[model samples]
Target chain A: MLAKEIIKKIKDAESNITSVIFVGCGASKADLYPAKYFLEENSTKIRTSLYTANEFNYATPKAVNSNCIVITASLGGTTPETVQATSKAKSLGAYVITLTHKKDSPITKDADYVIVHGFEKSYAEKLEKMIYALQLAVEILNQFEGYANYEEMINGFNNIYDLIEKSAATVLPQAKEFANSYKDENVIYLMSSGATHKVAYSTSICLLMEMQWMNSGSFHDGEFFHGPFEIVDKDVPFILFMNEGKTRPMDSRALTFLKRFGAKTTVIDAKDFGITSVISEKVADYFSPMLISGIFRVYAEQLAIARNHPLTKRRYMWKLEY
Target chain B: MLAKEIIKKIKDAESNITSVIFVGCGASKADLYPAKYFLEENSTKIRTSLYTANEFNYATPKAVNSNCIVITASLGGTTPETVQATSKAKSLGAYVITLTHKKDSPITKDADYVIVHGFEKSYAEKLEKMIYALQLAVEILNQFEGYANYEEMINGFNNIYDLIEKSAATVLPQAKEFANSYKDENVIYLMSSGATHKVAYSTSICLLMEMQWMNSGSFHDGEFFHGPFEIVDKDVPFILFMNEGKTRPMDSRALTFLKRFGAKTTVIDAKDFGITSVISEKVADYFSPMLISGIFRVYAEQLAIARNHPLTKRRYMWKLEY
Candidate 1:
């Protein structure tokens, strides 16, 4: 089912929803973050929480109940912990919505609504999970309490994919340069703030560490001055995502420090890609992740190519009992 | 003011707090996670949110209002972002509580209640900030809805310092061994589950990276298999905190995988320190962080000694305007 249809069904059947919980694992979990951030940023009436699927299952929040909506995703819908979490949420009387690339997968078995997203079709399709999750958040707020910029948000969503494609093309040269310059680096640290923080996190763990087997980590741009900034030096490699949002100053502050320290840095700024040209400035932050996620995929792909490592290359994932 | 006194004042003056917001920066922000986790784990009535101090100041959550309690901290109470965040929360009509080691710091200016925590006096003193935060969480839940194990929680608090001393002594040999074995490692990855997850995070960013200038990262044990495990190969160093909580299985599962792959690991088990002998099994998870935080200081100190790096060593913190 489409995200709109699922939300309409929930709105028709439920009138007292008080919480929204997003649960998944790894990149799927990271994909759910924009939606969670959006909901928390826009709505004051509902509580928002995000958790890894296994943690949600093992140490479930007390807030997961009859008035909660649990939105979970797994790319193939076969992650055991996620499937179990979906079943657990359903058992606890949550309105469960599961997103996956495949239909009739185990995660969908217990979900009240199953959204079969696309990953192998096109640039826009690759972001189906994140887009749908954001749509769910936007529509929920619009239906429940009436968002002030509801029309602007919907328009941003409409133009985001095309903007992403254009942005990706614009950054290809820089992405290739990033791949070559940092090819031999042992560790690369990423930083960002606001809505795109998880984009930095997923790119660090999934793309760098998992795909390229390079040591990588991500920190909130606001958090850099606290502890992580102590590691910045003349030759340390950093990939910073500069947001075009309220927290953009945090990114700029960190960038200033990194520059002063003479750190080797590659910055992907949303503003530079003309994000505001397609997305309204009022609701641009909510759509930054889609552009950042889409553009970073190009960067990750280039890095994989430069390192002669296939993005599918994995040392232990799905190859062993673990 | 003592944490109990602060709670008493709040109990007398305010009866409509619907949310709790924890804000700080770096290790300070990481220290607040246990209390946030405990509240979410135990209470359904109170919404809990945590943010880096700057983020809270810049893009304040709409929930921060007269119906909210904002708990913020800084060690010497001089972190500009945290001080500003405290001021912002107070302006938003939140009942602001600020915790710090120093008296009359900038952060204390706008706070309704100020808690002067100890950091230099004793082993338990080192954890005063975390202890007070946890106490606040426990008291809030008990005052609002009557926690089932409130007595157990209070007893645990009373006995925690002594238990931490004993646990530190018991782990001394292992800590020294860990320092020696890992003295030359460039990067060390830490992992844990439940409340102590932030312990690993603090150890990574503050202790290892900030103090020693080593490359380090931490991840949830529940999240290790998803992406981080791919970086685990023979001789890769890891420090795993094994909890005595409901999420203990998650740690054990990751440990099993780490062992199978021959990753060099140091495991810190709260059960081994006899936490349940003093704290009840039901409330042990919330207190695991206190024990872990206190005990791991010994490990960090030993590592500093082995690496010929003092814990006070810093490149830029307080040395420059970043």
Candidate 2:
């Protein structure tokens, strides 16, 4: 019934919806990755782009139109840029969809559609819940766009929590080992591609840098052979996400190179996680990043503990004006 | 005459080109940034996306079509991925324009248009020459697309060499000071937005990480506040690229925060250079990255000298097979 209702409203807007833009800030940026992946890979019917709330609010790329659909997610729903961008999108006559943990949050005031989830106990929980909300929107839109694999995702959607829970349980020991081995390292490089690239990027920024106070950056597997791979040596540590998708070969190339160079490499492979049991094989790739993100949440926590830094501890985040 | 010849061919194919994708690897990735900026900001007539040659060759985004025009650049033109992707673009029935330092490069064999520049004696010269070729294509395409600012860019094109040469001279002292002050630091953060964001990203990867063997990553200025800023402490150094563009306010916000937090900050502002005198004020933003990049090449060289690392030194790049 909920999906039908949302689909009906989108159908009513179908004539006017020429573009779709996903806007978010901070950890909230990770929440919209699924929708972005969906729109980019599946939606040949509409123009799509994702932007940080700050960029969206500032220049407002010419992609936004009077008939555009602007989707934003903020866990606290009080991020200044996301709220402001929501208002700006509204003023531009674009339809706004705001996802938040709080039903009556700041962004809701300016959004046309508001999806709220129950309370989250931790940042990881918030991310998982928000991703679920965003992916639901993606599947509905995918069905509308007549993607052949829509049913696979729709069926798989029902078991997302199960898949993530199972994935976390299976990945915990490996994650703990990873955290213990690399906790003292000053810098780390993460590599992945396709839908999983967001997880590599966001985890490096939000968890490694922000939570654990470690220096880290994510490089696309496809672009790894470019200048970024020059940093590879026996002394450097690499964390590669090996997903079972079209982009898997790219990651494999990076993994082979890192292994050859004797770089200390840790792999988080989606194939080992039993994703096919929970999701259709056809759409398992679509959920690889979500599953990997679940595994990484545990890794980040263990990393924080091993490094003697609390995930909640921050030098400037909530304590200062920045 | 070269511009006219290229312009005529593009004009003849203009009706077929509904999309333009810029593809490259390593430093060549920086060449297409101007074309991406032009299309994203100035052209509602065509869809544009920038992709690494690896990604472009592997999972070509749904955007590439028979009606697509793909532009790619490689200095040596020997990068296997770039050459392969150029061929793949041609196979897709997309028009391919390849820029290289060598007139008889590998990619030239697969391209519809091959633009070559003379040999460069230094890394900085190579970048300048590559960017010149790429921007020439962007301006000519802009003219075909009826962008009003195209004329200004055409006029300004004649003065780019002088502008960059002057900008390099003006920013040299500041760059040397930056190199001297931060040579010992292993990790640094770079931030910029809009057209300059590519410069920030590329400089960090190519110059600081690859060439200088230092650790660095770039963040979009608008996304700085989200979570990456949490890593900022008084000890962490940040290089901020401040351009006179619509995204200036976003960078300003981050700069204001960093200044208040007392972080070591390096500011490379376009306005500090004489770019406005070399180009029309309306189109000066288009040249901001080019100017800043010229300044950074000197900074990177000085940094390599201070750190006792040669820019040509590499651990795995070209030394190992991936």
Which numbered prediction scores highest in TM-score against the true structure? 1
Cα error of candidate 2 at position B31, Å: 3.0
Q: After superposition, how far is residue A60 of candidate 2 from its true place, in Å?
A: 1.5
lDDT of 2 by residue, B37-66 (tens): 766665544656677787677667666667
- Specify the poorest-scoring 10-residue window by lDDT in model 2 chain B: B118-127
DockQ scores for all the models shown? Answer: 0.74, 0.56
- Highest lDDT among the candidates is held by which one? 1
User: Per-residue CA lDDT of candidate 2, range A1-322, in tens?
Assistant: 3544665687676654556778898667766776676566555446566778877776776666666778888888888889999989888878777888888899899888887764455433545544565565564566456567767776776776777776777667877898899998989988898778778888888888888778887778887877788878886988898887677888899898888878899988888877787778777767788777777778887888888899898877777555
TM-score, structure 1 vs. true: 0.98
- In candidate 1, the residue pairs with backbone N, CA or C atoms under 3 Å apart (3 or more residues apart, or in different chains) clash, namely none
TM-score of each: 0.98, 0.93
